[model samples]
Target chain A: MATKKPKIRTMEELASAIAVSRPTLSRFFQDPESVRPATAEKIRQGLAHVDYVPNFFATRMNRRASGLVGVIVPLLTDPFFASLLQTVELAALEMDFTVITQCSHGSAELEANAVERLLSMNTEGVVVAPLGEYGSADALRQLGRSLPIVFVDSRPAEPYTTIDFVGTDNEQSIGLITDYLCRTGAPPVYLGMPRLNSNGLERESAYRRWMAGHDLRPEVLPDDLAPQSWAFETYAYQTMDALFGQGLYVDATILCANDRLAMGALQAAHRHGLFNSRPGARTRVRIAGHDDHPLSRFMTPALTTVAQDIDTIGMTAMSLLASRIRSGKPGEETVERTFPAALKIRESA
Target chain B: MATKKPKIRTMEELASAIAVSRPTLSRFFQDPESVRPATAEKIRQGLAHVDYVPNFFATRMNRRASGLVGVIVPLLTDPFFASLLQTVELAALEMDFTVITQCSHGSAELEANAVERLLSMNTEGVVVAPLGEYGSADALRQLGRSLPIVFVDSRPAEPYTTIDFVGTDNEQSIGLITDYLCRTGAPPVYLGMPRLNSNGLERESAYRRWMAGHDLRPEVLPDDLAPQSWAFETYAYQTMDALFGQGLYVDATILCANDRLAMGALQAAHRHGLFNSRPGARTRVRIAGHDDHPLSRFMTPALTTVAQDIDTIGMTAMSLLASRIRSGKPGEETVERTFPAALKIRESA
Candidate 1:
């Protein structure tokens, strides 16, 4: 019969068994350098006799800062966020930092929990694309005070005193697309989500401002009529289907807030026998969107949209955070960086 | 003017100033529980006078394991992986575990590097969707020896002893779709990636077996002619274009390896003026795919494909990992779990 080994429950027990003081054993766990060489060797031998695994969370609390960087995105299911995360991870790796990503699933409570967890782990810094209007502003503000944080893609509903931000020039991008639509065809009606985040609000505002300047009426799907989910494609599809049934936008062009919405709306149009064609082909409907997502080009009649400089945004945010981390300064002035978005002309528009 | 304060450089200096032994000061830094309450208070007060951020990565070396659970996927930009990641993350959260995801970017070197980093972090466990034949099998096998690892989606080319796996039943799924396609139209030709991973190879083999059972010729894109990149959509699009240019399969229906590839092929067909309709309709061709990706339903004419039970796969992988972790037995017999796939008949086929 095999003999059973004894289970050591705590570090204190193991320390006592080795005839070393508990503090000396604890010191060995923190860093072998902190303890004398002979004492460290004894602790190592003591560990060999027992199955003891230290509580990592509790260990983290005693440490100052980890090399880990936390990245929080609103939704991992969104290709935009997915692409952005890939870029951020690659950049972090280049700078010798390992990134850990968390998805909020578009909930304030979950976002708060993610932040709390990151803080508890003693993360050195964070790059977050916040949940915006739906996020817990208080938790984020509190976190900003303790660690180096850089906000990307969308800013928070409530501003932080010294947090840096990196994002696309949504106003310019939306206005440029709107102007092109007007010049080539009928002014496009805006179709988008509710005020979910700063990006959504800014894009809507930019569309309204551009339409007003061009003397064109701005039409949008009312809040009550829009779908109430983070699944933008499904929402756009359902919204467009309902609109088509009601004979709304019979001869109008539509500009979606993002490429996902456009994909869904385009599918709805195709299902309704509205084949997309070139600008002068007298197609039933003309559709365009922002954010030239990866699949946008693969869509039938290819989607015409604006492409944000995702690489630049990710690199800039990382560079800014790296400076802050190196300087060990959390009291630096806020820096705002914006990358330009370019128009991608394809078959749809 | 603010007075210049003396900088306490090392832990030894702070220990002397606080009237505590250096080992006791280190003990407080490891875990407060290791030192007496009185000694911990003195160390805390001493820390107030200095800006000392301990090197956390070095400290982690002394600990046995971290609270972190690693999730490795082939690519983050793929919506299929994104959705799977979301499901796994939610499940992990339900079990009170936080997940950190890493993308391998479809490179074996990067995959190896990711596994190495996760091991260095002393992660509790890992759920990985490997890059099939392209992954670093040795690295994964080495990792399996130290931790509880559950392979999800695509398995590694070289199997390790006692490694658990959870995935979709690709053989049954391919046969079901192929039978449906054959009954509805002409025998579909196999369009897919090179044998990059088990999923691709298994799918291709299944397609061949199904075709052979029906006394039909097996048709696949020659290996030398296939695209080399992991961008499946681009590969499909380019392959279809090149094939069309060569005047191959003028009236034949295409059975794509996955939805992403099908989307690309469909786009290529559309560009080539081959609008897909019902099998008997007067359209240029029909196309069907597997793995009903999220965007497949929103495609023009929607996609005809098979839906893998992603939720079940994710949930099962997590559950299996949780059990292995609780048991603390890395030498357990290997377990393989496969979930059935359902055929979703849409307009394309």
Candidate 2:
């Protein structure tokens, strides 16, 4: 008798009959730049026809020995930091690695302590939006040497020394805001936290330079940034009220240090009976902020601020950390990648 | 030869110089309460006078083994949580044990994930301010048998079986507020979360009970509990505006669910120009809230609120966890502790 033909199966029948190898069609899930465009398109269209179910865990594990990423942020209360933290968290989840986060909250000792704790836990690699201060640099380098440590949003004093840094160009971002205010209205008032304490020095210096280049006057308002400070929102509100009481004629636009201060300023304006929808309510004064906090879009008339590329920051950080972790590179060759910022024109501006 | 030469230090001399450890000093330093009040006072005074430093770490190590206490909260953005977290952190720091805090952000998966992560990190005990749902008593117990777990501010199902719990007496607190409103003016209209959420149920029920007992009309206004999910503040504000426009008699005391809702109500009132500063302002409606947030006192005509004993919650949680870690006794009975709330009478009331 003729040997019973081993049940003849076409490629479609074989792919549909067994669920294991469908995920091996990487050309299906990935984009054209990653795989051929025509091939990717064919696989994509064919996936629905064949009822493919990719083994995500298996493919991820096979692709890499293991996927583990660590993310660190300065503080969660600050809306900017919170937004950034949330973005990175979502991105890491998409990549299918368990992202563990720690908040340093702007304390050197606490930052160091968190770093040590993360190190003791043996995370695959770390992405730190660190408190850019003196003591943190050495600790960061040590951690970088041991495993991949990608710094985000802030960097150390010594650049091109060690580790990888990803951040928005602070000078360019603030300069754009100042230039917008000057164009739309009068010279803007720069309201910010104390200059000596943080990386805001870059923004403050940029603002001063921008004003000088435009041949305009600059009014800088710096809040005292003591350690373990009091309420920043209240501080901003009270400061603005005091300035107004002193007959300081702030121009139409106020460029805030960040969204937190701007929100506070809006609240202050409300309390002072400004910004109401009364007849002829529009004043020369306008409130502009930065970072586009989650609540910003919900605020009255929304907020006009600089939007940072959080997706890029997250992806770059992950890639840098993964490479360093795999290579175990101890050599000090720090990278500072600066991303441009875009002006998010909204009602406030 | 030294003994023969009488090379000895006198207690009087030592006490005068280092200013500690005489007849009763040792007991006071070891445990302050063990000594008589007068003796303890004298020891403290003498110690302060001499400016002596104790070997705190050595003393701590000698007294007990290293104990790990865990703290978990729903969100870190709310300053109420931040304030409580800080207190717990300080308490843990003083107790000389590590504290691992995880933010669940109202996610069950994240909550369980944090618990598992803490257990994997070998936490000795845990104190959780749970999201009031989806906590597994069995799995939590199985993961860390030796460690004592304490629930704070929210109780899980089967409390006596798995862990100790602590929170404020919500019913009595709300009842007191209700009584105060009825006694002073018209019966209060309860402004509460739209959803009958688990944690605030007691407060709502208490308000209802008080209203029924007094034979007063209970007008409960429902509000969006998940403020972040919707345009909550704005919705609440506009709803109140419409209520006013329809000649609604809202001139009675309004008891808000929490400080945040009260804040929105206050903004609405201000926008409508309802609140006044004249003697007639006394006749205007009053508003009060619970959970005295830091910003509560800063609001115009500072808010009247019930201040829960958050410090006690933290301290008790730490102590229970420490005890559980040290004993490692699965046979140990579970416990529950509730703290009283205090009504802070402020301007808005």
Candidate 3:
């Protein structure tokens, strides 16, 4: 026969068994700070004696801060955004903050809707990686009027407002990648979008200029997908396949628009059965991209990409937004802080 | 020279262009239903004529419901949870509801905190995938007392008076997997935690019983990591590697505890080069698991997993909770709804 475990009846019985009060026990559950240190100790001892465990949700209401920080991203399926958002969540946990995340699916209306919902909650503040499209800008500007909203990844063109901007220097960052590719080998095909308001426009322009400076002809792919519908792999895979069918010739190297697109390029290359490393590394086709997403390391042969400083971005954005929340006055100084990106040399390139 | 686009100022100017009053224009943006049919048309024309867009947050404020539904999960780093939560968000959007997602990190305190925050926002309701061990049952129950709270994936022993629940049929679903493995191949080595919650315990028990019924001895490799740590992959990888190194060979198949752990096992098997398919029609060391996570399809050779009926579960839970919300009464029946799991036969057994 199995031994039966005894059950606890009341707080008093449990307290008496360990040797502490009903009030103190309640206080400990409600707010840990509400009870005296000595009383808390006695209650802890009593709890062990009776083996009484309080209910899960009940103890939470007994505490404070609600532990929720609202996080809004452009999309969740995008590995780049997912990696950065995961980092922010980890940082929030370290600060004892629970994160409530939402993806706008690149819709300005949805972004605003997500924000309004977050505001309804007892969110300390919001860390938003917004879509730089015109609609989202206006929506963000409106949100800036109320809460301590921190803008991440996307940079709003309005230079007068003091919304904290934490992101990489897209132009300079991509320029470095372009320069390296041009210097090490023949200039690779530049894969990017064709939009003016897009922050990536700066990167594309930088690549063109860098190529021209090196006296190399630039081959830019034209893409018209809306920012909301733009997926890295889908674009890259189709475009690369098209390039292959068109009998486009390459110098055994490719520079992708982003890490996701690069991953797609790798898959395309693999489909062509071109993965063997030649003696002296001559037969290896080099592929590189930007934003070293967390999963980049796990990809086949890994990825040689540029890494963004998201830690500094998240922390600075939060602190800046917190100050604005406390001031009650909208900020005037537009401090556009840009974190430098570094090249990560891996198996791919 | 490029033609310059004209910009108009003031709502009245835009309204006049489309033959509408400023008040109607304002009302249209606030709530499209507030105006007459003709008036709404005129206002939309006014908006399009000058491209005048109203503030989303301010406009939504005029509505009765915020259209915000809170979604709380344990963490975002786990791809499986990330994918599940993403699906929930899509479903909520299809119902014209915005989602606010919070991560509990499998902590009871954090779960409670997220609930309090959601309440402070006066959210319509919350769908939570809680950490069963985290002592959040009471906090959730308290919320259930006043608000619509739906439990997803995890359920407390003591059901909430008003809260609704949606989850997979752990016992029956896992039993199906165990039965299949036992019939077709040698009883697999049970790899998982010694003591587990609903899903884990159900899968473990099914394995044990299936082995016993088939007149075979069960080999258990219980993980030593604490449940709260949320380190499923690390431990599974290390354990599988250790077993492989020790020359521990049993049946021709490996049954993983879950899809996530199965993913780790697959990676380990690949690393050791023992997971290759045979040339003939013979099954090559079958590997099967539960939970058809999103990544399961994309894996090399795919995966043979148990598919949970996510759509039915989500919709049922929402409808049940919504009824409770409308009636202003707690649900009478404690519904323990269990959906069957279907086997997805892929390359990996």
- Tens digit of lDDT per residue, candidate 3, span B15-43? 67777777877777677898999888766
Writing each residue's lDDT as its tens digit, candidate 3 over A192-219 gives 7424234566677778887888788887
**lDDT score at residue B56, model 2, on the 0-100 scale:** 25
Leading candidate by TM-score: 1
lDDT of each: 0.81, 0.64, 0.66
TM-score of each: 0.83, 0.68, 0.70
In DockQ, how does model 3 score against the reference complex? 0.10
**lDDT, candidate 3, residue B344?**
81
Ranking by DockQ: 1, 3, 2
Enumerate the candidates' DockQ scores in order.
0.30, 0.04, 0.10
RMSD of 1: 7.3
- By summed lDDT, which 10 consecutive residues of candidate 2 chain A come out lowest? A55-64
Worst 10 residues of 1 chain A by lDDT: A54-63
Better of 1 and 2 by TM-score: 1
State the TM-score of candidate 2 restricted to chain B: 0.72
- Per-residue lDDT tens digits for candidate 2, residues A225-263, read 422342566767877777665646332578887776776
